[model samples]
Target: MLYQVALPLIPQVGGGTARTLVNYLGTPEAVFSAPKDRLAKIPRIGEVLVRSILANKEAALRQAEEVILRAEKEEVQLLYYTNTAYPDRLRDLPDAPLLLYYKGTANLNAPKVISIVGTRKSTEYGRVVTEQLVQDLVKHNALVVSGLAYGIDIISHRAALKEGLSTIGVMANSLETIYPTVHTRDAERMLQQGGLLSEFPFGTKPDAPRFPSRNRIIAGMADCTIVVESTSKGGSLISADIAHSYDREVMAVPGPITSETSQGCNQLIKSLKAVPYTRAKDLEELLNWDKALAPASLPKPVPALDLSGFPAEQQQVLRVLQQAGPTHIDVLSRHTQFTMGQLSSVLFTLEMSGLVKGMPGKLYGLV
Candidate 1:
């Protein structure tokens, strides 16, 4: 646990680098113990990073020990990327943080996770829509995720609480403090119902730059992201964009053109970056939530494919499609850990063999 927490504390070691080190060295402890010469030989390790790792190893461990002590005192759980408690939705994201601080009882890997985001300066219309949308989603048993900021973000959280649903507030700062202290009470309630999550450790401030990083987690940890309202620019749009890049579904609610808060969502829809969110059924259909909830006896089993003749990678892709139904290409790349070129080639081969069918929007499903 100490080494896992310490890996990210080393100077100049970003999430990607830390993951790379663990991938090559087998464990975080091995990364710290490896000789400088051995570390330097790994691709992209570079001389500077190798030296930094060696020189800061002890310091990082000391900082990690302190962090663990504080975490224990606060009853915070440290979620390393490989830990079973880590959100599966985020595990495959290349840029996901290596460690997260989580506190709450809600399952992080809930079957249905939906992020609700929008402008901090929300209007009455936005509030009504956000609340109604969440209420409608109760039947789907969706877990709500949001930034815990003012306006739509907080409204969504409060609405979820009212509806008896678990909602996670992904914060930019450490769990020790909630920004915009007015929402502290709501956050406390969330601790009992849902929970708070953050990649930053204790004492980290909610700085401007950290919000975008926080937005990615809100995007990555969910099956989809919905924008209730926003202006031309804001953290909500950033979250939508991140979700889109992850190949996760993104939905934006349409609003009056005259309203400034509606422009961002309008623009997102116009650019074909997001689907227009009208009602809860839109989500239920897009994610097959209704089908998932249907009685088991009502569904037919997928026929087994002859995977014995296919290459290992091809079989793996087939198996994923069989289990997940239709999946986007980018998602396939993440799940299979294959580069785009590699996944594309493999998909083409499968398509040619009639074992897979390519759908619109780069989605592929087993035939």
Candidate 2:
């Protein structure tokens, strides 16, 4: 399966063209066996790729055999791209891997899946959301997918592991090695829960260019790709774009507009290009997920800010702020634990206390 397909793929320029030829030729074996003159006439069968395919016949066969033996010993299932079990969504893509080496029990064709992506410099917001959203997805029968990068990517994968959820990690490197090196333990755990996936064969080192192509597969495999956070330019958005091209759902969570890391998501929402989702529920509603949940809800933002020591006034203020986004001091007081007259005094005191800040809308936040 990989040999004939690989011939066309190696040429770089004609990779897509060769993939198309295989689509028409029916199978790699058939393509390889076709009469030379007959194969030559096909557009873009170009001499280079055709000759490579013809010349590498023995090497391809030996490689395939070795691959099968390795998979069998490791208990990994080796799937040809054309196999019925090959992910239908992925198979449709132009650069889909010619073969997949998978471990674990989750179906590649699972009914619900979403890719979680973000930057290496994950903020508090990205980490919180990725952890929460992945837990939520797993509870609702959705498998989590990610690139296994640091920060948001690994946060999502680790959360899935904690939740006892199956997860998949797409890699920019070949199966022979780990890219970050630090995440090898996490990757090992993932092999038990899900599997590692990549288009590159063994010994392909992680490269700068491979990341963009790698990101596309992460996006293409999922029903939707959720960017926990990204800058105005990064691989996550590139993946999002490919997901959109594949007609998959693209949803982004909004963040403070000032942060360069979140600008991409906010821009996506503003353009009315991707769905805006703040919490796990937002994703579920968009995907129309209906399933039982076993995991705990996301931990509160202020886990250590226990209100136990606070008086009713502060507690009430926090409660009101929870219902509202950020609240004005006077309005927060009026809505809870004080009259309008008392509210002004509390507002002044709270302002002096430095627990909150004023915004144009009279809104306040816990500083």
Candidate 3:
């Protein structure tokens, strides 16, 4: 679609005056090409909006042309709501984005798309659980989607790439600018591996308010939204709420009962709004993969642990740590009935092996 048609629809772009102009002229292209009396006949658009449209039209048109050219060069496909490529799930939403820019390998309407979402500050447990779930879903030909935030979002994307699965990162910013700056490299990688999608115009920054709006897209784009972990109140919960409003499945993995990070998931399950996601099968079972996948039924992922580099000693230490969290050295020694020296050495080896992490004041726990 032309910017002459698109730019005026930008609610805040032309301020209070433009809404009237759009109301009268029906579109900016009409306003731009209309005579002065024709413009004057509009309710409140006579002077200001007409002038704004007249002055801004050529420049807006030029910028729109540049966006189209950039999209062509970058291999990013543009999807207006009226276009066939626009996701059917999002089309019915009340406040859907006017346009979506995409670059990727898979179809936007892929049947098995699942949204993976969680807290920006994810714990080690959250990381493992999120990656494991993504690995399973992707193995079954599900498109793993997320908001491209830090923590769980980045982890899922990287894991999906490692497994050669399709990944989608929906951004709060525009195609020209990336949010959180740190993930620019991964965002670029996603465009090559899958794609980066956005509703914002070019050069839009990640303003704080835009995030909740962006979460709606992440919610709307998926058949189901899975929360790996979240705080009591956070973006993932908002996404889940929106998913419910859209009549999509909302699933969450339970964390430790004592964990502050797990509160969100627990609350969601407690409300009876979402089901506990214990395994990938739980998701697939409800997803009705036989119908979604049709003739190209997805192959189930092999349920197995990857222990390629784990040493026997390190593995034993991890087993002990898993059995008892925050174990004091003496307690651990007694529990395992190993000598203090053996336990100390084991902890050190485990720390170095990345199987265990040392907490504040020398407390050690399995990572």
What digit string (tens of lDDT, one per residue) describes model 1 on residues 207-304? 99999999999999998899999999866999999999987899999999999999999999999999999987787777767665677874578777
- Rank by TM-score, descending? 1, 2, 3
| Every model's TM-score | 0.92, 0.72, 0.68
Give the C-alpha lDDT of model 2.
0.72
- Candidate 2 per-residue lDDT over residues 1-367, each given as its tens digit: 4454344334342335655666667776666577767667778667775676667655666766666666678676666666777776676566666666566667788767788888888899888888888767765677889998988899998999999888898888877587799999998988888878876655579989889878878987887898879899866888888887765678998999899889999988888778998877676656545322344576457533466676777666756655675654434553674755566565566668776565532356665
- Winning model by lDDT: 1
Count the clashes in each prediction. Answer: 0, 2, 0
Give residue 121's error in model 2 in angstroms: 0.8
For candidate 1, what is the total of clashing residue pairs?
0
Instruction: Report the C-alpha lDDT of model 3 over 213-303, residue by residue, as the tens digit.
Output: 8889899888789888889997889999998886578998888889988999999999987889998777766665533445766555433
Q: C-alpha displacement of 364 in model 3, angstroms?
A: 52
lDDT of 2 at 160: 92
Q: Give the deviation of candidate 2 from the true structure as CA RMSD.
A: 18.8
lDDT of each: 0.91, 0.72, 0.74
